[model samples]
Target: MINVVIADDQTLVRAGFRSILDGEEDISVVAEAADGAEAVERAASERPDVVLMDIRMPGVDGLEATRRIAADPRLGDVRVVILTTFDLDEYVYSALRAGASGFLVKDTEPMELIHAVRVAARGDSLLAPAVTRRLIAEFVDRIKEPPPAPRLNSLTEREREVLAGVAAGLSNEELAERLVVSIATAKTHVSRVLTKLGARDRAQLVVIAYESGTVRPGWLS
Candidate 1:
């Protein structure tokens, strides 16, 4: 089972999430918190597999708490899924940079919510294809340059190519077709690129690739 913690400032939100998750056979709500500080404290103790977090909260807030949880090695690979009503790019940017494994609007369907949790638990990502494109367009509109190049020293040329393709929102299947390889092989390359770049997931890879100048904005369109 995927052990989870629900952290939000509103009791109703927490209760609602708890209700949605409790019905899933593959998941269990191990704990719940109403504020970021309490969420951090509980996270240290409970060490859940995933945290469903709200970005806006009283004290510390979800973003900072997520940073703390993500930075601490003692958390032992606990992943976070930013579950919030707001889909502000800043929140998404901070969350992805902080190593959150998933991002979803709170109004997301119950099934999607559950899937997001499962994806986080498995160390996969929930940055959908459409979200990826939207993220790129949003970033492009805000800045002339991508964030900043990630420190990539040892990556192979092939890995770099795969990284660029990913920045264009190419799914693994699409990547396979483009690279003339099997889907599994494409996934392997993508995973290796992520590991080399210290990216949390494909979304982070895309951001890093664009911002770092690994992939140019010219190619995005």
Candidate 2:
């Protein structure tokens, strides 16, 4: 089973999420925290596979908690998925930069929430096309023009292709099938792309791809 931790300040919200996730046979809500600091502590203690972290908690906010978790050497394998009220641009950018696996709206459908948990547990991201556009718009709205393209030439042509696929919202399994390679090989390519790009997560890669013009806006559809 995929171990999960639910971190939300609202008691009712936590209860709702627990009710939804607890029913999943492949996953379990191993712990719950009412604030960011508690969330961090619980995460350190439980070492869950995924953390459903809510933003705007008292004391340390979820963004800071996410940053702290990402920086932890012991919790490197734990995937953080930020749960917020809306797809606010700043929150999206900050969450991705803070090493979160995804930004999710709190009212997300039950099945989608379950799927997101599974995706994050596997060390990947989950972003709908609309949400990704909102994220890119944060940079676009601030700069008014594209930043100079990031130098990703350290990657071979194949690796770049793989990155493009990832930016297009293809999973590693889908990419392997498309590229006619083993799933393990596809995963390696993704790892190399993230490392060479100095990206902490795939959500950032998608942002870079669009913001850098390597992948056009809304290309994932």
Candidate 3:
């Protein structure tokens, strides 16, 4: 089963998510928290596969909680997905940087919520193309000179392309179509890139691509 912890300040929000997720045979709502601190505590104890975290909480807040969870070696397998009222929330990017696998809008469809949990459990991100474009537009300018990535030279030409596609938030199938390769081949390339870079998942790949200057703001256009 894909165990999950729902961390939102609203009781009804938690109940709604729990109801939708628990309805799935493959998923289980293991725990719920009304704030970030409790969320982190529950995560550490339950070690769920995913945490549906809210960005704004009373105390530690989702951003800090996410950072704490990400930093904890014991919780390495835990993936945090931020919940926000707006898709373009200012803190979403920061949450991603804090090691969240992705973000879901509060009003996301029930099916989408289920999909997001499944995706994160399998160590993938939920960076939709439109959301990615908006995220880039909103924060690209804030990225000053990217830090050096000495390991970037380790990538082959094709791997470089894969990394760029990931930075642009392309799914494996989409990437395969763009590269004119089979989906399996695209998956292999992405796996190779992740392995070479020691990235946890596609989310980290996005961060690495941007920070390494392999992909720039307008490159997706």
Q: Write the per-residue lDDT of candidate 3 for residues 1-221, one digit (tens) a residue.
A: 99999999999999999999999999999999999999999999999999999999998899999999999989989999999998888788888877889889999999999999999999889876467556755685577887778999999999999998988889999999999999999999999998899876788788778777788777776
- Candidate 2 CA-lDDT value: 0.83
Off by over 4 Å in 2: 145-151, 177-184, 216-221
- How do all models score by TM-score? 0.86, 0.86, 0.90
Candidate 3: misplaced stretches above 4 Å? Answer: 180-182
For residues 1-221, write the lDDT of model 1, one tens digit per residue.
98999999888988999999999999999999888888888899999999988899887888988888888889846888887676655676677778676588889889888888887788666655466456555655566654645376568888888988887767789899999999999999998987777775776786777667787555666
Could you say which candidate leads in lDDT?
3
Question: Candidate 2 lDDT, tens digit per residue, 153-181?
Answer: 68798987887887777888889998999
TM-score result, candidate 1 = 0.86
How many pairs in model 3 have backbone atoms within 3 A of each other, for residues 3 or more apart or on separate chains, i.e. clashes? 0
Q: Which candidate has the top score in TM-score?
A: 3
Clashing pairs in 1: 146-211, 147-211, 148-212, 149-212
Write down the worst ten-residue block by lDDT for model 3.
Answer: 132-141
Off by over 4 Å in 1: 146-150, 169-174, 216-221
